[model samples]
Target: MLAEERLAVILETVQQKRSVKVSELCNLLNASVSTVRRDISTLAEMGKLTKVHGGAIALSENFAAVEKDMEEKAHLFLKEKQAVAQYAASLLEDGDFVFLDAGTTTENMIGFLPKKDICFVTNGLFHAKKLAQRGFRVYIPGGEIKCSTEAIVGAECACTVARYHFTKSFLGTNGVSVSAGFSTHDVNEAQIKSAAIENSIQAFLLTDHSKFDQITSVTFAQLSQAQIITDRLPDAKYRSFTTVKEVL
Candidate 1:
């Protein structure tokens, strides 16, 4: 096939799958690995896709710009997210004011919280609704809600978060690197997370192991500001930068 035709096919495959592996693309295109690699590289350079190890994912997969369906995110890391949420919930004390950031893993903690009189604030609409239904004092920051992530963010949300102080906060991120610290794909969400960290006395990051090596658009907080709660310990590369607590 001509280079132009091959590139068109590759782009179509990426759009359909949201991500594509080099080997898979090679098989589908009936082309040599080198040719497929070149196409991927060219497309990546043109800002059509992001090349990850062993594969290339559509650049739009990162955040709001892409349609990240909520049902798909809810199914990812199901068991691991639940375990991390339970572990985080165990750390909560009665009557403690808590801030919960928006993410599937952190949202899981809502199911495990005690049914008592405690102040709960969140930037996640789902979380706020769950907590309110449970009869807990829940506050949802005022802002525009991004449909893709169900996260409320913007200047209004940041201003609301600044007015309250929490005893502890639980946050989640799209990426967690030793050097990059906690990061997310959206700048507005990152700003909200930063505000949460500053307003809370103690902060804990709840994320799955998959986030450890990735890098996202905006860095929200440093490693020192929060302890990480995950199912497995991080590799040696991250050991020097932060403390990771492995939850069984």
Candidate 2:
């Protein structure tokens, strides 16, 4: 096919799917990787599409403005969340000082936690309660509890998290974008998440494949700052930004 035809096809595909991988375009256009990449670059330069690490995404990709409540999210990706949580929990060790973020995925990690000499600080009311029930020493910050997600957020939460030096932090994000990094809709929550990541020695983002290529209202942390643990990696380009572990 002609270069013009390839570019047209690429633009159409990105418009339809919001994102298209170079390899997928190669297969669709019956063109070489170099040809697809060049076409993507041309479109990006023309402001027709945004070129990501391994794919092209629509310039107007969707942003999540609202968060799903725990009950609504509990069953959305139950299996995938469990798998990712299991892997995250395995990283815990004796004498570790951990920070657990509030979200359905991070909450799933509670059951898999082993009995160990560990201390945890969390901003999730549900997470703190679960951890305490499991006989793990847990601390919860004093802050305004956002009922929608049952997470504590505000100046108090961010301030409390800043005081602790955590060995590891497991955080949840509403969206993960190549340009925007890890994001959430609420600025207050974002502040707390950012504070936790900054105060921790190592940070891990726990999310599912659905998060990639999406952005939210506020960015909490950059991609390079944290390792990612997900059920699957939809794009290879994400690995270049940080370490990504796929549980399944």
Candidate 3:
């Protein structure tokens, strides 16, 4: 195929899959490794995609401006996120108070949680309403709600979360790094996440493979602060400080 045609195909595949590995793209396009890499580099430079070590992901998946349209991310990495959520839900006991973060991965945990006798606190308005509708005791923190992520965060939300000590808290972040720790795009949300971690006896960081190294604007907590639960072990750079428990 021509270079333009190959690039178009690559873009379409990345948009459809949300992420595309170099080898997979090469195989699909019947192109050389060099050709695939060059195409990915060119697309990334044009701000069409974000290139990672093994693959390239659509830039739209990470942009906050488009987060409200969660349909774009709902089907991406579904199995991996569900596995991570199930593992996270298993950590809770019958009477334990839990805090759930706002993210696609964390949202999966709601379906896995038991329907009765649990107190759940969240800055995620969607989670709060879902749990409440299911007859579980749910508390929605008071604060400014960001419609994009359906998260309520601000000083008020932080204060409310601080008042209630949780048995466990499951958080999601935009990025996880040994040096930068857990980071998110919104400062207010980061503050609420930090508060949740501090108020919980045990904290778990839940993320999928996509969140490995990409940094965001604000740092919430360090790798040392919580046990990391993900779809797979992170890169070699994070093996030391992060206690990774891979969810099958």
Judged by TM-score, which candidate is best? 2
Give each model a TM-score: 0.72, 0.77, 0.71
Alpha carbon lDDT of each predicted model: 0.83, 0.90, 0.82
Q: If both were scored by TM-score, which would come out higher, candidate 2 or candidate 3?
A: 2
lDDT for predicted candidate 3 compared with the true structure: 0.82
Q: After superposition, how far is residue 125 of candidate 1 from its true place, in Å?
A: 1.0
Please give the lDDT score at residue 54 for candidate 3: 69
Candidate 3: worst-modelled 10 consecutive residues by lDDT: 60-69
* Residue pair clashes in candidate 1: none
Scored against the true structure, residue 158 in model 2 reaches a CA lDDT of: 94
| Candidate 3 lDDT by residue in tens digits, 1-248 | 99999989999998887667899998999999999999999998988888766677776444221122345666888999999999888777788889888877888998988655789898887788888877888888889988778788899999999898999999988877554578887889899999999999999998888887555666799888988998986475566885788977
Tens-place lDDT per residue, model 2, 47-147, is 99888767877886655656778899898989999999999999999999999999999999999998899899998898998899889999999999899
Instruction: Output the TM-score of candidate 2.
Output: 0.77
lDDT of 1: 0.83
Q: What's the ranking of the predictions by lDDT, best on top? A: 2, 1, 3
| C-alpha RMSD in Å of predicted model 2 compared with the true structure | 8.8
